[model samples]
Target chain A: MLKNLAAKAIVPVGLTVTGFVIVCSILLYSYVKQDLVADSIQREVLLGDIIVKATRFSMLTDQRESLRQTINDIGEQKGVEHVRIFNKKGVIMFSSNDEEVNQLVDMSAPGCIECHSGPVTAVHLGPMDQARNFVNAQGEPVLAITTPIYNEPNCSNGGCHFHAPDEKILGTLDIGMSQAPLLKSLATLRVRLVIFCLMVLVLTVGGVIALLQRNVLLPVRQLVYFADQVSRGNLEINEPEGTEELVSLAGNFKRLARRNLEADDSLRDLQDKLDTLTRQIREREIGHKSGN
Target chain B: MGFLRNVRRPPDTPNRAETAAAPGRERIRRLHRLAYRGLWGMAAFLALSLVAFNHGWLLPPISDGARAVLGKAPPTNLISIALVVYSFSALVLILSRMSTGQGKYKGWSHLAYLGAFYVFYHYGNALDANFWAVFAAGLTIMALEHYQMWTFCTEAIRKEEERLAQAERLEKFKS
Candidate 1:
């Protein structure tokens, strides 16, 4: 059923082109998503780190009220879910919300699990590792970054503070941001990619099919008609138009037919000569018999 | 009994052409059938797998190893690796084409293509997307190419058979 040139050539090529486009689109979409999400994570990590740095002086000077107010102000920004500083013991020393000032955070929580789940706490973590994604109580997606506040010589040697230098991590500055914008961007990207994929499929598949029809199928059909005419004893045929290869084949076919025609004409002439000779010989034999 | 005794017996041995062509023809036929079946199977699987994975109807086993490896490497690196492997696979396929026999050394080509699948799977895991799209595309190309080659062989064999039949007919006419 699929033995025709169009079916044999166009179908497979069209399908392969479509598949190729789809595969490429999937990979491209994936790469784009990865890049965008990675950028978002990096941005959140950088913001969290900057907030920690800004609050360092306030913490060193024992300005808890000022630090709390600063956290509250940062948290109040659009898309900023919450900002807080928690001590090493998981106690919320200062938070944007006053009611959660001294609350103990669960060590097993999504944001804390990266560092605290291991047998030994991980002091250093990559930006991706430090970032966590979760849905908050309000059922909105939030991305949180936890930056560790490392103890430095200045903090221990400062005149107002008396902390041992042996203490490595003092606390963690955790920041949560609503992921509405990122999600929205990703959703838009997905829709765009799907549309682009469909567009590519149609264009490529249609192009392939059209090319095959013109360059392959049309010429093949012409040749088939030419061959049928020749088979039905119609030696004269118009040259089929087609690709170079097919046109060359038609040329060869036409030449063969011409040769056959020439051969047939010569054979007919020879047959006529032989018939005349035989008739002349028979007449001569009859005359000889009658004259004798 | 006299009529049965007068019955002439034909030769039991097959002709050289038949013997030579029979096995090769059968092999090509089998390959063509496989290609046809595999093409449809790949198409169906690709569609179902993509939809299933996308809708979370079919969840792959939870494995973080692929995720970790994919996350650490940039997309460029992953793509580069896939491209290198794909080039190697394409070279193998070309070499197979250059060889005299159809479907020769196909196992090596298959093995080479499997390397590409590994990269696809890694990316899929990392992105939580369906890798079957890539896999099925590759399989479809391979199967189609095989089908085309085998079809050509089938046509050649059919022509050869016709020529042999013509010769046999001429031989019978001479007697």
Candidate 2:
């Protein structure tokens, strides 16, 4: 079967198609994965904003205990990694974990560097830039969103507040969520994509082989048989069937065979005539000799 | 056997050629019965592809089967399937014509397989089993045609070789 012409044609085609499917599937899966990651980050960013707003009243009223409780409650929620509110000086004023409160954080951290990476720290950053992804101390993937708190007029004008009106930024709200959900989604996507790719490859290649076997290989074998018989001078053989070209070729061969038969018939007729003429001449010679 | 036996040849006449050729004629007839059956098989496959492609009555089973095997929702866009079918069929038709020529075998023409793959990828969401089914059927048809043509040519060559060998033997005998 390997030596057959159909195999020679189909093996290369199947390989080429498999290569194409693998490459295209990988590229497509990567594209979809990137979108899912970005979407996950976007969701984290939105959640950060909502948490910041929920704690706004407590922060404005100087309710440090209430704000701390709110942050802790949010951190205890499912998939919530941590929630921290930091002062402009990078001091962790209120944190979900008590151990982290009052500790000074580095201004150039993954969650902070997006805004503080420049020569001067940025007063405001877009939601996308505010979101950052990293692995936490436990080696688990995390998506963190850093929302800067802008100084409002009420804060500076209030009796309990000492913030200057000129201060454009007050502090930052940083929240991190576990990336397990997003990773699970991505993993599922990858599996589905791979399965889909393999399925397509198999169907296409399998279909090709089936079609080739029926249309090409089987027909070729039959044509070879037809030719073998014809070559052995079997003009009474049936016409082989296949593709139009093969059928046409078979028709031509049949015509040629018929022509050969006609020529042979003509030869046989002339031979018979010669035999009859020879018999007549011999009989005449015998009669003439006898008469002499 | 029937025709040659009915001929009014002499009882002592040498029937060397007919005696040599008659053995395999029955086998050839049997093989051709299979070829005719294959013609019917091709027709059935073509009919299946058409049913698989159409959106009307018979599509659901084919589509569902494809989906179950695929492990996901298959693409259902008629326009994309139509485009792929059109382009792939046109390509095979051209290749078939090119293959019939006695010129150099264009191995490069097989690159069209890659092009078809790319087209599927470009319309990735629209690539489905129905499109592939149709495409595979057309390709198989063309490939079979080429295979038949190849066998026919080879058989002709073999016959010519035999003739040449016979002529050489006859010349030696005459000399």
Candidate 3:
């Protein structure tokens, strides 16, 4: 029956296990999401650094076209959303998207908030400062990394171009990478985690029910059947065999049955003896009466 | 009928002391029965409380009292305390029922005490690594004692009863 002890016991255990599994799955999903975001930021930052390093020589030689070509080539790579070179005035000097070049960028955007948020005029770029995530114009997720190009002594002291020695930073190279692929993969992982949790819950409940049937329900049912037989005065019925505890209980019942049958036999014998003695005494009295 | 016809009536007799003691003995027996039932009831209550507390299914006043005693949050699996209380109550019940004259029941009482103690110890320290070893040792000792008592009661006592019955039957035939 659905209302049996096995069902009752298994329901609580199943609920506990399922709850634990769901909690663990949620924790795992959060951890994985954080790790994925961190990994993506690190990769994009490294890419920005490489782009800056590759274009430094061209910028030093004043080969503007070659520098722009290098930025454009890197931007065209798989997962690369956009790459741009910007001046200290927040002006886009070069860009993978040509239309955006020569346009002034908004300094208050999410990508620039890390550097512009403080009273300190000069922002010291660190590894963490180089990367950020924001929603693009199309509502797609984008990872933007800003790598600063420092003014070197060679550029300031060179004969071709005049530069100020006090200029701490020359420009910033901004690289934006698409997060669509990473998001898709994470979505797949989430789905898989949900499926896995459901499977684990099902398996746990099913296994518990099976074990309860084997270890408890079957033995208890057998004992109940044996008890019914005993109650009906079937003393000759064989004992039910089961697990060690059940076997011991059955053995005790069988011994009790045997004892009861022995007692019944003894009582019957005593009653027969008393009956014969009473008949003999009755006959003796009748004979004596007749003689008198 | 013949037996009653042949029997002679004895003189009417009364014992004031026996009459005075009868009520006292009856009262003591009633008290014993009540005590046994009360102990079992306490054990049942303890079990129900344990379940209620662990599952957060307690009534308002009892829940408030539990929270006040054990703090706002208590461990959910406190079945061990319930088990210990139940076992101790059963042990006391068995001991109360045992008498000096009933040798069989006395052995049973001792066995019950040991068994209850073993249950308490085993469940109380169920999280321990040495649970199986301790349980095995207690079970072995209890089983040996049980076998000895059972053998004495069944074999020796049954043989003596048979001997007495045979003697009685022989005397009846001679008479």
The DockQ-derived docking category for candidate 1 is acceptable
Q: What TM-score number comes out for model 3? A: 0.59
Per-residue lDDT value at A43 in model 3: 82
lDDT of 2 at A186: 76
A-chain TM-score per prediction? 0.79, 0.87, 0.89
lDDT of 1 by residue, A1-292 (tens): 6677666655555555565555666666667766777898999989988898898899889888899889989988999988888999999988877788899999998889999887999899999998888898899999889999999888899888678899899999999889998889878887887788778777876777798888887889899999778766687678797789998888788778878878989999999999999999999999999999
Candidate 1's DockQ is: 0.27
lDDT (Cα, tens digit) per residue for candidate 3, span A1-292: 3347776556545544554455445545655775788888888778777888888789888889998888888878987889999998999999999999999988878677788877775467676666788888888888888888889998788676757988978888998888999999999998998899789888998999898888888899999999888766787777777789998898788778778878989999999999999999999999999999
Each candidate's fnat, in order?
A: 0.34, 0.00, 0.00
lDDT of 2 by residue, A1-292 (tens): 4457666666546544554455445445555665777787778878877887888788788988888788888889999998998999999998888899999999787878787788987877777788888898999998888888888888888787678999988998888889998788878987987788788778877888889888888888888898788877888898777899888888788788778878989999999999999999999999999999
Docking quality tier of model 3: incorrect
Q: Give the poorly placed runs of model 3, Cα more than 4 Å off.
A: A1-3, A233-237, A277-292, B1-175
Residue-level lDDT of model 1, residues B1-175, one tens digit each, is 8898889898789765556557656765665564455355445545544544463434465457866764654455465347445634554454355344454424334434544454455544442453544464455455555555555555666665676677667656765
Candidate 3 residue A197 Cα shift, in angstroms, is 1.5
Q: Please, what is the TM-score per model?
A: 0.70, 0.60, 0.59
- Candidates 1 and 2 compared: the better one by lDDT is 1
Arranged by TM-score with the best first, the candidates are 1, 2, 3
DockQ of each: 0.27, 0.02, 0.02
